[model samples]
Target: MSSTANISTRTPDQLGASRAKAADNSTGKTPGPHRSKHRRLWWTTLAVGVVAVIVNVPWFNALIVSFKSDGDISRGALALGHPTTDHYANSLGAAGYDFPRFFLNSGMIALGAVALVLLIAVPSTYAAIRLGFGGRFIMNASSALRLLPAIFFAVPYFLLMSNLGLLDTVPGLILANTFLNLPLAIILLGAGFRDVPIELEEAAQVDGASTYRILYSVLLPILAPTLVAVSVLVFIFSWNDYLFALVLSSSNATPITLGAANFVTSTGIRWGDISAATVLSTLPPVLFAVFAQRFLVSGLSAGAVKG
Candidate 1:
């Protein structure tokens, strides 16, 4: 009884020390959660850095080649030999490349296409979501149409535009690009539209506001961010279009994407000029995306899709 009482009376520190000694003697180690966590963090950071490098390699190579001369490119693709601005000068069409004009042509077509897409898609999406009887069918049909590649429409559209005397013109490119953007615009803008409360729309209707009035006065203000998102997407789509521009237009409507092919002359591929043009051509969309990022954040923060 006395021994048991003494054991029970032992201080907590002594008991803890005994248990620690026993544990050390038995296993000689303990695995810490923090050590494993640190290891995982290190590996995750390394993987992210590696992925970023891989993704940027082509753009980095383009950047390096843009500053280099044609001779330097021949020496090595990754090598940074003496850099010069002559490629940019030549590609800018001062030396007869027509880069500026093609860039302007791309902008006009992309912006015009965005306008046409909005003009058609906005009303159509509104009607489909709010007023149309067969909204699901309309949306499903749009999705089905998207599955049909834009290339499938190219030859037929070329013939149709040619018949209308719109071939090889900016208007021709605008019309084709608009068609290309419609499905995407409808789907995206429609998602935003669906989030709007039907109650407000009903109230406006009860007050005798016309359909167009409620759409413009009440809903559009709330949908500004979403509208910006759709506009940017449509602009980028038209801006980056190559196949349609290549198949439909020849000279006056050549976008930068198609015009980039001009560097493949009979004398051999002009690598430096091509690189310079690529860098220039990529700038607008990149800049636009950068600028529009604020709107994207604002829109998402403003509202979300409802069940």
Candidate 2:
């Protein structure tokens, strides 16, 4: 009996040890998945950070160089021993290109284009998405239009503008920008409008709302974020467009882009002044991007899934 009892006690001890070992094994194994997940997250973060730095480095370098003198910039030197505001001062001063005039012209044209694009695109997109009138053909045509290079239409556009006596004016640039940006605006806003629940519109209509009233009160509010995104995109496109401005605009209606291009003379290129102006010129887009980044991301993601 004593021998059996001793065996039983030893067995229990052995079983307890086995259970403890198992518990330890399970506990230790749990960290493996966590470790792997952490590793993956770290790698993804590192990759994104690296990419961001790579993309932003050129702009950062240009900004730093903008404050430096012409000689300092030419040497490709990192540290500016004699940094000065001369470049900015010169850029803004009478001696440099008329930055103020150019800025104003570009702003007005971009704002006008964005406004018109939104006005036309929102209604068209609504009709396309809600009414479904030749939706596939419309989308396909817009995509195909993008495939054709902008320069292809430049000659035709120039001739048309000249014939209409609309050449070298803000109105001409505004119209050109609108046409160029309209397709993209329609694509984006159409996708946004489509994502709106049909039930909501139906409910609005059931409440004795007219089509225009339903759109204005119900749809526009939901599409506000997307509208902001499209506006920023259109503004950037219009602001940076050199080719259209070059071809369409003359001395009286010259935009900042054309003015910047003209900075390079036959004799020499003014690197400091050019870089300063470029940096300054980039501010509006940058500011808009920074402010609208969240909306932009949301709009793009939502549009992509629906579109």
- TM per candidate comes to 0.82, 0.80
The per-residue C-alpha lDDT of model 1 at residue 147 equals 74
TM-score of candidate 2 against the unseen true structure? 0.80
The candidate 2 region of ten consecutive residues with least summed lDDT is 1-10
Tens digit per residue, CA lDDT, model 2, 1-307: 1222123224555664575556656776465655655665588789999998999997888788888888888887675758788888778765646877888889999999999998888887788778886777877676566567999989999999999888998889999999898877877787677668899999998999999999899999987877887888889889988898999988877888898878765358777887788788889888866776665555455445444
- Model 1 segments beyond 4 Å from truth? 1-32, 288-307
Best by TM-score: 1
Question: Each model's C-alpha lDDT?
Answer: 0.79, 0.79
RMSD in angstroms, candidate 1? 13.5
